[model samples]
Structure formats: structure tokens, C-alpha cells
Target: MEAVQFSPPLGYVFDPTDCELVGFYLCNKIANKPVPGIDYSIPQYDLYGSEEPWQIWNFFKQRLGEERDDQDLYFFTQLKKKTSKGSRIDCSVGTGTWQGEDGGREIVNDNMRVGTKKRFRYENKDSDQHGGWIMHEYSLDQHSDYVVCRIRKSEPALKKNKRGKCQEVDSEKKKKRSKVQEVDSEPLPLAVPPATSRTAPTTTMVQQQIQLEDETRGF
Candidate 1:
């Protein structure tokens, strides 16, 4: 499949919930389903053994033309494995190595473990500035056979209090629904003249003339 770019929505950022990431986006990707009205979105790409973090960031920024103020980046990628039966992430990618921040965090769906989210910091061999680069690795269940990762700058403030920002989008959606209901329920009044003055009385009887044996009777 061709790589489709994902542009953030106007006046909002792309911060999907854990449930949405697993249930909606990843499920549809696994099913090869196309999302409507979304021409460009997180492209399906394998990042494990690909270019370095900076290269990946630059490539996406060129495609996006503008960086999201939120600075959180997302991608849909297939997990890299050491062997068909082995369970290890192949660490050989570009110039530097990817290091996990903490032990993987369990991302739950419907009270069941669906995937693991791991934070990574890129340590570039040539420069110390690369240490600030961060990536979020969201690997699905072993049965899923696929993964989606989010890349971003290392900022502790952005990660904290993120759920509150997500709620803003929800509130906007509710307001839209209310506006639609109000327009639908409000009746439209049409100008109508009074019925008695506007309408003429109908003629119920007509004079009739009958001739029988040269005699005529009128009632």
C-alpha cells in the first residue's frame, strides 16, 4: 500500500485515547479498512530497522508542512522480530540505538491487555542534542502481529494533563449535536389567512325544473 500522510485536524490536535488507538485505528488498519474524509493520516511504515529519529522527523515535517504544537507524532508500523518464533525487538536501525525509558506500560482495552506502550530516547553517536528526541512504541498483542508507534519531542509538561485537552474535542462534538437537535425540533411557522374570511361558502342546493305529462313541479 502507498504511504498516506496524516494531517492533524484544524483547531485541534491528534491525541487519540488508548481505547481509540487499539479499537478504532489499529483494528481498522489490521482489517485494511479505509477511514472516510481522512485523505492523509499516519502512514503504515516499519521504523525498527529504518532511518534514524531525526530523519524520520524531518521526513514527516516536510510532508506535514507545519509542526503540531502538541508535538506528539504517531505512525502505524509492523513490529520487527529477531526470528519468526523469537520474541525480541531488532535493535540495529540507523546510526544510533533506541533505549527504552521504563519497563513497558500495559495499554488495556475493555479491561484486557491489548498492547504495551514503551518510551524510547534516541542517543545519537555524533551529537548530544539527539538525546532530547523521544519516541512512543505501542506494540500490539502478540496475536495482533502489528504495532503503531508515536514519536515526539521530550517534554514532561506535554505528557502531563493530556487527558484534559482530549476532553475539549469531546465537548465540541456535544455542542454540535445539540445545535442539530435544536434546528430539527424547532417548528417553522407559515403565514396563513383566517379560514372563515379567506374561504367562500360552497353552494349545496341548485334549482331544478322537471316536466311530466305537460305538468311542472318545483320544490
Candidate 2:
């Protein structure tokens, strides 16, 4: 069968929870059943090959552009045996390796155990130092050879708190602008006409004075 290629719309993110990854995507995939949008959302790739994590990140970054800088990536990769008959798997990628952070954890769905998930950190093979790249590996309890992986860069807590503060500041500025706009939109009070001159003669009075002056001239 031909493998399905996934090409998401701009700004689209593939972020499935652990239960969804195992109970839904993985189960249907291993059973040869058709998953509605999996063919377009998640693609099979050689994640353990020579490509580093950043290279994978850059590929999506360039394809999706900066608009998707926060997007998470997912892939379907099969485990590789280290020997002809051994249980060990080779997880080396390029010049770095994925080191497990803790023991595997169980993923439950609908009050039943569905799968297991494990966290791994990418470390430089030479220095053995970890980076910001983190991955969550998910696998079915019934099937372990094939698994789904979610990878993303870890964000610093300080940066997240700073962003929250910035958002609050922006919200306050918007509120002030809205109030100014409302004031500008309101109609100004009708300008009161300057008090009419009290000494000015009325039109009827002026006409009477002209008549009296004509009568006096005639006499």
C-alpha cells in the first residue's frame, strides 16, 4: 500500500492527547483501518535517521513559516532492532540521541488503560548535554514496535510569565483607547448662541420709528 502524505493548512497543529494517540490513531493504523484525517495530519517518517531534531523543526518552520512557530509536530516511526534477534531498539538520530527522562507512564481512556507514554530528551552525543527539544513517545500496550511521537521545544517558565504580563499590558492599553474613541464619537453639546444684545431694537419697533419720523417730516 502507498503511504499517505500529510500536508496541513497554514497554522495547523497536530496536537493529539495521549489517549487519542494510542486508542485512536495508533489502533486504527495498526489494524489497517482508514483514519479520517490521519492521512492528512500525521505522516510516517524516518525519525530515527540521520536528521537531527532541529532539522525536522526547521523543515516545518520553513514550510509553515513564522506563523507556525509554536506548532507541534507528530510522526509515525517504527522501532529498529539493534541486532538480528534482540529486544534493544536503536533510537539514535544524527549526532544526538534520545535519553529517557523517566519510566513509562500509563495512559487511560474511558476508565480503561489504553497505552503507555514516555518522555525523552534529545542530548548531544559528544557533550551529553540536553537541549530544549523534548519528545513524548506513545505506544499501544498490545503493539510496541511501532509508536507515535510528539516533539516540540520546551519554553522557559520565565518567558511564559513575561508573555502573560505583556498581554495584560496590551489589554489595558486597548481599554484606554476604547474609552478615548467613545468620547470622540459622542456629539458635542449644541453651542449656545451668544446672548442676544438687549439694546438691539426689534424689527416691529424699527418699522414704527420710521413711520413716526415720516409723519413728523410731513407735518
Top-scoring candidate (lDDT): 2
lDDT of 2 by residue, 134-208 (tens): 888999988999998888776563355457668989999999999999999999999898877689765788899
- Can you write out model 1's per-residue Cα lDDT over 1-219, one digit (the tens) per residue? 234565656654467886677667777777779876323456666677657666677777666665653466678877667888998876544777777788888888778987877888777545433565677777667544587777776545334335445687799999999999999999999899766644766443342222342354333
Give the per-residue Cα lDDT of candidate 1 at 146.
81
Per-prediction TM-score: 0.59, 0.63
Candidate 1 collision pairs: 5-40, 5-41, 6-40, 6-41
State the C-alpha lDDT per candidate. Answer: 0.67, 0.77
With a 3 Å backbone cut-off (N, CA, C), the pairs that clash in candidate 2 are: none
What's the C-alpha lDDT at position 193 in model 1? 75
lDDT computed for candidate 2:
0.77
Best by TM-score: 2
Q: Which stretches of candidate 2 lie over 4 Å from their true place?
A: 1-6, 64-66, 125-129, 155-219
